[model samples]
Structures are given as structure tokens and as C-alpha cells.
Target: MMEAININHFNRHKITEADIIRRILSGEKELYEILVRRNNQKLYRVIRSYLNDEAEIEDIMQNSYIKGFTKLYQFKLEASFSTWLIRIAINEALARLKEKGKLYHISERAEELNKNTILEIPDKKQLNPQDKMIHHEAKQLLEKAIDQLEPKYKIVYMMKEIEGMSLKETALALDLTLSNVKVRLHRSKEMLKDSLFVISHDTHIFEFGFSRCDRITERVMENI
Candidate 1:
């Protein structure tokens, strides 16, 4: 019983990203699976924002993981491992977009988009859904609204709101200025508020299911 308890304790102790990177770099390549599983959901949403096709998104995901794995030695700890990984994924998605001649109309016109972008998050406590159906409907409406936003704003919003990235991290991943990230996030929130006309917060958009997660990780492991 004591030996079993020690084994359970060792397994339960979480591995930090830096530690995992070190292990993978030191020849324990299987440890890369930990990083893949940890960031799969965020990577899916980030890449999906650029490409709508499910198959293409999965392809970009697998490619991004393989790219990051090969370039792991170049990773600097100045940013979180997740942020570094997000940067790679975003670059991969944008490359795929450019190749397909569907590059977004991303401009540096923060000044133009900033106009009337100062909408408030209105009191949403009154609009809470009481049941699952209402919640699902509200979520769907919110997602449709987000889908309508410009790429610049949508990416900022996904990184900040959906993935819970810090402002600095989002800026780093998107290669936008800190001020740009803030302005675009504000505009994105306002757009959602205007489109939904009620609640402005829904945490269920662009869900990456377990099956897809396993599939992407498996492909990456096989290729790596």
C-alpha cells in the first residue's frame, strides 16, 4: 500500500512546461505529449480563427507542433512556453492563409477602428440563462457574432477572452503592439455586445473536443 501511494503521488505531481521542454530536449521525446495535450484547445481556437475548414485546421495544428518540436532549442524563457507555442501556431495559420490567397484585411488602422469602439460591457447579470437550452442558444448567438468580426479584432479577443492570455502574451503571439492588442480587444468586445444585444461573455465558443485533441497529438507524435 505504501509503495502504491508513492507511485500515485509521483504521477499526480504536475510537470511544468519548462521542465517538460528540458526533458524532451534531453532525449525523452515522449514528454512532448504533455505540452501537446496542455495547449491543444487554445491552439485549435487560434488556428480555427484563420481557417474555417476542419481538416485544414487539424493539418495546421499537426504542422505547428512538429515545427515547435524541431525548434524547441530556440525557445527562450522570456515568455511562457504557451505563448511561444501560440506564436508558432499563429505564424503557421497565417502562412496557410497567405498560401490560399485568403489573407485577412488586417491593417494598422487602430485609429479608424477605434472610433465608436468604446462600448461598455453593459450589466449582464440580468441576462443570465436559467437553463441549458437558453445557455446553448445564447452561446450560439455569441459565436455567430464573433465570427462576423474582422480578423484583427477576432484574434485579439480569442487570445485574451477565450484562451485567457495576458495582454503582453497576446501582443507577443500576434506580433502586434501592446496598444494595438488593447484597442482591438476593446473593439472586439463592443462588436460582440452590439451583435448579441445581451450577454457579452460566453466561454464555450470553438470547443476542441477530446477526440480531436487525441487525434492531433497522435499525428504529431507519429511524425515527430
Candidate 2:
């Protein structure tokens, strides 16, 4: 029986992602679990930016990982594996949207589309139960506002702001120019800030918990 390996073990050994991929391609197939565990959060966030359905997002994520594994030989070692994987995930999500007729091209004028939007967050510390509730509600509101954004802008925001991916990596993943990524990110913030009196930089807005992470990893490992 294969034991579940914690990603921290990889970190402790200072094993690079390239090394893992090399080993996986060299017949150490189980090492792929390390990549899955390492990227589950980021993959979930990127896919969540496109689709709102949790089950659908998990399905797409599983398919993306399986697809990526099958195509591991084609992955360029000099490039970032996360970015490559994200590109695959994004393509999968877009294909899903296209199948449902929800995929629409947003022109360069997407920044001008949603100008009159407002999102307000109350500036309160979560010192007590009541304050915690308020904070939770505020996060939900912020997530809803993000979800309502056009796909183009929302994707940029999700990658740069929510996922904390570098500008270069985000551009590479989304196939956008650096300037375009900056522009979309700025416009996304402006769209949200127009009505957002107070902003909270909560990174845990669309958190994918440990249980779901394990489930996704197990399912993908089983299928692959």
C-alpha cells in the first residue's frame, strides 16, 4: 500500500519540482502525488475564478491533473510547472464554459464594462463571536463581488491578487502580456474599489480545506 506523503516532506528535503517531475517521468509515478498536493490550492483558486459550482470545479480539477499527468512528457523543464499546470486547468475550465455556451469573448473594453460597482467592507477586528460573524459576512460579500466580475478581469484578479502568483507567471499562465495583466488587475481592483469603502486583504476568501484537497488528490491518483 502506498502511504500518503505530506508535501512538507518534499520541502524538508529541498527537492525541486523539476526533480520530482523528472523522477515521475523516469517511472516513479507516485511522486506525482507531491505535485498534486503542492498545487491543489492554487489550482482550485484558478478554477474557482471561472466556475461557481464546487462539484464542477472538483471534476475539472481532477480532469486537469489527469490530463497533465498524461502529457507530462511534453512539459518543458525550463519553465515553471505550476504555470504549465495552471494553463491546462484554465483551458479545461474554458472548455467547460464553452460547452455550456457560457464562454464569451470579452474585448479590450472589458474594463469599461463594469464601472458603476460598489463593494463595502466594514473595518472590524474579529475579537468576538459577533465580530467574527461580521468578518465572515464581509468575506462572503467580497467573494460575491468578485464572482460577478467579467471573466477576463476576474481571472486576472484571481491569479494576481488571490493566488499571489507573480506577474510574469500569471501572464505566462493566462497567455497575456505583462502590461495586459497589470491593466486587468488594476481595472479589477478599481471596479471593486469603486463601491468598496473598506478593503480587507484576506487571503482565505475562497479557501479549499484539507478534506477536499485530500479527496481531490486521492481521486486523481486513482484515475491516473
Error of 2 at 115 (Å): 8.6
Task: Compose the digit string of candidate 2's lDDT tens values, residues 1-224.
Answer: 14655456776898999899999999988889889988999999999988989999999999999999999999998788889999999999999999998889553434443545444455565468877777778788778777767888888888888888899999999999999999988878876755441443567879999999999999999998
- Report clash pairs, candidate 1: none
Considering every candidate listed, which one attains the maximal lDDT? 2
Candidate 1 Cα deviation (angstroms), residue 197: 8.6
Question: Model 2 Cα displacement at 96 (Å)?
Answer: 0.8
Worst 10-residue lDDT window for candidate 2 reads: 106-115
What lDDT tens digits, residue by residue, belong to model 1 across residues 23-103?
789998877777787789999888877777999999999999999999999998778888888888888988888998878
- Residue 91 in candidate 2 has what lDDT? 96
Compared with the true structure, all predictions reach lDDT values of 0.76, 0.84
lDDT of 1 at 42: 91
